[model samples]
Target: MTGPRLSTRLRFGAAALLVAVGAAASVAAAPDLPARMVTTWDAAGEPTGTLSKTAGMWLVPGLAAGLLGLFALLPRIDPLRENVAAFRVHYDRFVVVLTAFLVALHLSVLAVNLGYAVDVTTLAVAGGAALFYYLGTLLPHVEPNWFVGIRTPWTLSDDAVWDRTHALGGRLFKLSALIAVVGLFVGEYAVYFLVGPALATAAVTAAYSYVLYARRGDDGSDPDAAGRTAK
Candidate 1:
């Protein structure tokens, strides 16, 4: 909604480019990296563990590629493919966000291995915050689909429940993202800002969906409730 609507091909291409750039960067930096790359870090940005250089270099790119493939396939195969189509723009935006986040992490790791003094934990927290903010933006616009949005038995069974829950979820998610931003200034407690509120938002949204479903007084067995038409 903020800019020109992008074609699925373009959005996916953007995500692919991010993965490719990270892969290329890894390759370019290969000779300079140590035998083992420090891959894990504590909240204070202290290195916690390492991965064999090759494995560390490729792992995130591989995961990003795999996720890109999965995101492409899921929309096509979902039972409510039409619903996914209705919100394809936002969904694609989310895919790009997720891809960018992973690639950023990959490049950040690459930078660290190249002896750059990068604070990876801060980068992760910032990336996670951005991801959640995008998710908040996407949720309210999402249509009922098997693969995305806040899926629960209640939300799946009724479009009203799905809409209501997602609306609430959108706000909670945005709030959590803001809370995560606040953590950036708090020192070692930074990660807790991202984790705590995100987890709470998820739990709250699922429960809200359940309670709303029950309050509607349906046992949720009716096929028509799922927006399906019998052939």
Candidate 2:
């Protein structure tokens, strides 16, 4: 387990532990903590709405644990189990990054609840950029698993489709992350930078994969299938 599984377990375990510890600390600080805590921040850097302390403390850890468990089980349940094994390293790293992001988010909320001076928007933009960048890095190495990457039927059925689609997707995702970072400097409209790019990437990649698949015809004689699509 030292090579891959050990690291995987450690990544997931650490994330859950970190968040759980934070939650426990929060409760310790105020055992009678209100059912809801105001965690939201506005452009003026003020709290907006009250979030359930009980919810904020445990929500992310629970979600992280559930998702990690699913990631661990995918290989055993997927019909393309061998294909997943081909890029297990990339897959594992993706899971680790995701867990880290969740922890970051949980901490941000915890800090706000603890009355720390925090720029919630800045934290969100930075965290989003990092997560998107990692997603871009992961897209190309994905091997059509049921749980990750572009999972259109075309990508799943044809390695060529999957390769080409993810290649394009990786670029778009990286570009989206850059746009999100730039948006951090913008005013109230900064959210568009994050939302717009993500939507465009999803739409374009799904359409591109479908087109490529269709181009392959019923017999799968597309140029990509013949290994002529350039590496």
Candidate 3:
């Protein structure tokens, strides 16, 4: 692929437009909720309350867009350009979906503030949205760039490590999507619905690294062996 023919100026301008549009939409869509401390019961029969009210919903998209616009204007300076071509589609999808999830999450917070009882359907949709967005981060082209993907020390050290971790991450994210989808039917266990998948994903990724390391030998002498083992 020759890559898109977009010049730096055009790309920057387009990105700015997107940011403006997204910011406007997010502000318009978000409703003002009360400042009261909202409480919700978790799966363990404990009530949890913290400040869910956020101005970030209105601000983060624009901030992200601004950063992206800056990157477009000077992609040569953008660190993510290294492996971007490899994961272009995945990266693009990830950004779009992630933005959507953020928007949805902010909207849901607004709904809760307006006294809309967070029900099973709402929980499921929210979870699903988040999971899908996260899944995009697992694409091989995505890698351990600054803003996306799993950015652990191990993953950042070697391209092989990053690739393996992301592959594992993709599967975990897909599983999380399934778990979240099923959670929709289980009702108020939504906290568990969310927590379970996250924990599972973390556990799997950690285990994957450990297993890969062990198979690679203590001296770190066998790159081929390590890759094969991870695979």
Candidate 4:
């Protein structure tokens, strides 16, 4: 059966709550913040760049709103939207998780600038690990679609390829999340832990999909299902 559509509760409640908190914090902190605030950090978690106080405060909330909008829109625009509905419940939860991650990061940044000794980078890496781990759980349940999962030339062409590749992807992503979490304690090298594993998972999943595609072709499976799902 197709999964339920994106939850109105998520859209109006959890997401709204996060955005509201971000905005409220921005308002409360605006007076004490400098005209420009440090907003970028290097991989080592050192502050590297700045943004206007107004921009700094609103950045994540604005981005979150945009992302939530896009997430809500994708199912309508996708050709394989029915497949998206097949996992819509998971999809909605993913949206909430991602928004919360951003909110956490935004709050960390605000606190650090306020003289709190928050290790913003450590918090970011940890949040990333959580997000990636949840994504791992979500992948295997994804039906073939243009907007999500391990899309590749091969996976999009065949349902069997999509399933196997996503299954592999699900495992690899979880492993990546685990590896990334170790970065939380590795000091300056922590960001690399997340980046390295994530990149490897992407490369491995794409290659796996292609290999599955070619083998299926050799085995005489139809390769003409392209328009249904894939990049």
Candidate 5:
């Protein structure tokens, strides 16, 4: 089922909330801290950073919320609204889960940067956990649009393409999640682990679309065909 449409006023309100949160976070804590800080690790599991106490505490979550709010505006935009429902479920769930994860990550950063005696490695583990959870949420939908899911020319052209791409995407994202989770244990290689799966998925999806199109042939069945055949 389609979700309720958000009005312009509501959208503006959401944007305002994000701004307020960010502004509040900027000023919330220690008044004498710097606007930006660096992160450092000492021998005793403490995070030393150039961040001011107030700024460090608010930076991550506030930024995360703001970015998410920006993303939320996409569906309401002109071009995106055209196919908003194509992968609505996946898209919505992804946003929520991802935003929540970002919030957690930011909080972890805050704890460490604020000299709260949190382990840096523990933050890494938390990030990995969130990544895994996000993968689980993304793997089960079938739709094609500019954002979320797999977007290939073929997938955009045909519903069949959309379905097949998402099916493949689901598996790839799951695999990616697995690799990323494993990397948490491996240490340092986690960046490679996190990125490799997605790169592989994009390559596979692109190849799959070419093969599908070649196999399907050039009939009116091609969703890209804009005109109808004459009787």
Candidate 6:
């Protein structure tokens, strides 16, 4: 409860529980799938290539397991492990939300396939929007780390650069999320709303970091050097 205090054990436990739930859902949905099926839409509600019934049932749960495994391994492998600890709570919550997103996607797919009268496209779009919004919320809190946030050469090379880049990135990501939400009403063009803003943010942040780094020089000068000298 206090600043995302769940231990690794707890996080793994949570992931396992979700895996079980997903497995159960797959079982429940199995009867409905054609012996040989083709997936038309991914969980994000976007059109995709086809897959067999077996692949469809196992997809989300398998992905959930793999992602959880990756999350567990990231901290140990990161160069800035302490920095990750500085915002471990945020990271943990992000993982939880991601896992939930996957679970929700699995359910949505199952419901749609089973003729439950649910809209797969709408569910996918809404889920993606939620993830984008939450990711935006977490961006500013993330410290400089190898496996997360706006990783760039400049941001990784200097703390000052990291801070400024993340500040800009935070705003842009939040704005992107908002655009994605609005995109829902735009019909087929909604993917652009989700993707375009993200591309712009990535490009802008990378360039901004480069510019800031260059201005600071190789030794990392203070941006307020002139003002400090004047005083």
| Candidate 6 lDDT, 193-229, residue by residue in tens | 8778888989999999898888895557757567767
Runs of candidate 6 with Cα error greater than 4 angstroms are 1-8, 42-48, 224-231
Clashing pairs in 5: 37-50, 37-51, 38-50
Question: Which candidate wins on TM-score?
Answer: 1
Over 4 Å off in model 2, which ranges?
28-35, 39-48, 224-231
Q: Give the TM-score of candidate 2.
A: 0.85
lDDT of each residue in 11-107, candidate 3, tens digit only: 4455455556656655564565444434343464343654533543445565566656544443245587666655555555454554455445444
Q: Which one wins by TM-score: 2 or 5?
A: 2
Off by over 4 Å in 3: 1-80, 111-130, 133-137, 143-147, 217-231
Best candidate according to lDDT: 1
lDDT of 5 by residue, 120-214 (tens): 55465546556655664565554455655567787777776666666776777677777767866665545566667667877997888766666
lDDT of 6 at 104: 82
Model 6: residue 50 alpha-carbon error in angstroms: 2.3
lDDT digits (tens) for residues 1-231 of candidate 4: 322423545453687788789878889988888888888889987889999888999999899888888887888899998898888888888888998999998988888778788888788889999999999999999999998988788888889888988999999989999998888877886999998999999999998888767865566574655644665
TM-score, per-candidate, Cα-based: 0.91, 0.85, 0.63, 0.90, 0.67, 0.86
On lDDT, the stronger of 3 and 5 is 5
User: How many angstroms is residue 112 displaced in model 2 relative to the true structure, after the best TM-score fit?
Assistant: 1.4
Q: Which is superior by lDDT, 3 or 4?
A: 4
Query: For candidate 3, which ten residues in a row score worst on lDDT?
Result: 1-10
Candidate 4's error at 163, in angstroms? 0.6
Pairs that clash in candidate 6? none
Q: Count the backbone clashes (under 3 Å) in each candidate.
A: 0, 1, 1, 0, 3, 0
Model 1: residues with Cα > 4 Å off, grouped in runs: 1-6, 218-231
> Model 6, 212: alpha-carbon shift in Å?
1.2
For residue 168, what is the lDDT in candidate 6? 83
